[model samples]
Target: MGNFDIKDFKGVIPAVLTVFDKNENIDEVGMRQLISYLIEKGVDGLYLTGSTGEGFIMDSEERKRVVEIVIDEASGRVPIVVHVGAIGTKISIDLAKHAEAVGADGISSVPPFYWKFNENQIVKYYEDIANSCNLPMIVYNVPLAGLLGMNVIKRLASIDNVKGIKYTGMSHYEITQIKDEIGKDFLVYSGCDEMAMSGLLAGADGIIGSFYNIMPELFINIYNAISEKDIEKAQRLQRQAVEIILYSLKVPSFYAGMKAVLRWRGINAGYCRRPFENLTEEEEKEFKEGYKRIKETYKITGVEFLDEL
Candidate 1:
């Protein structure tokens, strides 16, 4: 991996979803199609194999294949940030090295979960991963990783090559504090789709969310609106995004709902892997109806792909 400027990692990065076949295998064709769709829509970056991508349920080989496919499909159009997080440190380190080897722009990992870990252990985990590879590391801050506070974040940020964080929580105050305590160049990406605007206003450098997989243009619009200092337009788009988020939550599975939306868009983003159910026929019908209502209400256009669906 070569030197990467933190500025290149900024903007509306999507925590991309993993496409799977009916047999629960990686759908490479569908995955590439989805990648093309997003790139054509103009996403700033791609976060592969994260929670939205169902990385945890996949094994090491599957994860590596995803990294390879995404990087190849992206074709240097946009930077790919592979999420190399795992329950085990060795696997996480291995994935981190693989990401760098495969030419990922950066690497990110959530603190080891499923077993209670102290702050020192969490700090050490990040330090180990950051040291494992040459690419810059982004600390993923989710509540499941034990609720990292500003103090813990500050400690982790001190590690060399630890560039920034993917903040998924609701605390806008922490976003400001991270930029305040850490440097302004510290890349803070809002992991929550509902708060894309608020996160930007709170000093977040960008956003990475599951919802971006379905409607990336909207989020891109919001980011551009904020950049142009069009607070009114940003707020309007944010409200529409939150409405879609609320409807998405009503589905049986959030990830499944997102995939369903992609399929509706003719992208062929297949179902979630085993242990996670896809939306039922009834749920799909309801979701499509709700989505139609949202599209009409928001006057969202330029998604010519949806017209065929």
Candidate 2:
């Protein structure tokens, strides 16, 4: 079994968005550049093929290819948590095994989607996948999954090799109860960017968010401040980060807005995949102005300058 465990999974891990060309093909070069850029920005880890990464829209081969590309680019510098959740049991297991084969640090998965899975069914599903790989598993309790409930989280957390839950639905207090009931060894991560500080205050070890892909330095500062017991600084940064998040929600697609920001910075990550809308010209213009506002209002350039060093 791999020595990889949950202890190594803490900190700001972005649910990275997959970069696509105009034809909706994966831009491998752009992806590699983005990975390097994020690593340079001091992000602790990457969560591949999650909702932000548009995992469900991709086929199995595409998902595996994305994971492989991310792993190859990352080169063990940051822990890579591959999200292998799928509708079928065999597919999920196969993705989990593929993640292990490709040298991912860990695996995270949403419960069976589309159907309302019972607690035992969900537990058995995760148990089977975890047993198939040496990588520690994180249960992603996504609100959109339609199957995850309080009972599901508690049951899944009890499974062997299931070391964490990415808490996205409901309130932090609900997650806190699960942590209290299950014991602290079960790592909890805030799945939403806007709720990161609140989740951390409620005992979340860290966050797995989409916006962190665009503004990692801000999140990292917030995390570091909290870790240093500087609650005041953490709160201030959190407020600033949330302001950017709120504006992003008004754009066409949140991931597209983030990709546009990267392109503005010369990253050239391309656009969001199809069916998922891209930013219109108007939104693009607003995004630039909004981004400028975030930087100036939150003093993000100063934060990023230090991050460069």
Candidate 3:
């Protein structure tokens, strides 16, 4: 893929989950299969090394390996936007350089968290990474990442190397305001799964959802339909997608449900790392029942999500 423009990232792009083996190591085979599955399902790109991918918890070596594995598997078929956000500036720069070296299509970084920083410091932190890498940078602004506001985002987006932003916060109005003030070329993506369509309506370029790892086709279809101005079809698919996620929410284990769903399809994206629990046998059973019920109820057919089965 040659130089992926921010506009080209205007469909569903999942922040894919990182698979770890029992030894707490990257499951290379599982990751490859996961990337293949997503591509086959018609995802526009992969948001590698995000919160869902356990990026913050991973060391620089692990982050580099994940990026390399994803780029190798992508094979220029789909764009891979690597997330190089780390708590430390040096490590984040190291990851960005690695992403550039590995032929990543783009790079994104979350604001430094756990320690409060003034606006100038945040700007410098991002500018440092954006300058270090050749890839266009996407500013990831997740509310859970210590509450940086849109004013800071506008300033950061104005940086020459900053191409776009992944706005994962709950503030739709702020996202709209950012889009309005920043002008075009500043692509903004929704970070939340449930608000995927809502964000699109509010001027988001696309979505970067963890839920897309489990349901790429449906989300991508809904996104495409919405973009084409087919609200009827988009709304129909969005309802079905949300219905399934509701089960994950009700089960009190969304990530666990994701792993179980992946395992059921034999992709082996593996269980999440420690402190993030996997599904029990009973939970898996319930999730399977929920999945089947959703498919049967919606009468879905010939979709990429179903092709995995």
Query: Which of the two, 1 or 3, has more TM-score?
Result: 1
Give every collision pair in model 2.
none
lDDT of 3 at 304: 45
- Best candidate according to TM-score: 1
Which residue pairs collide, candidate 3?
none
Instruction: Please identify model 1 stretches exceeding 4 Å from their true place.
Output: 2-4, 296-309
Error of 1 at 41 (Å): 0.4
Give the distance in Å from residue 100's predicted Cα in candidate 3 to where it truly belongs. 0.5
Model 3 per-residue lDDT tens digits across residues 168-262: 88778877898789886688888888878878888898899998998787788878888899988887777777777776786655766687778
Off by over 4 Å in 2: 1-4, 293-309
Candidate 2: tens digits of C-alpha lDDT, residues 134-239: 8889988877886377776777877788988898965788768877998888888888788788888889987889988878888998889888999998888888
- Candidate 1 has a TM-score of 0.95
RMSD of 1: 1.8
TM-score of structure candidate 3:
0.92
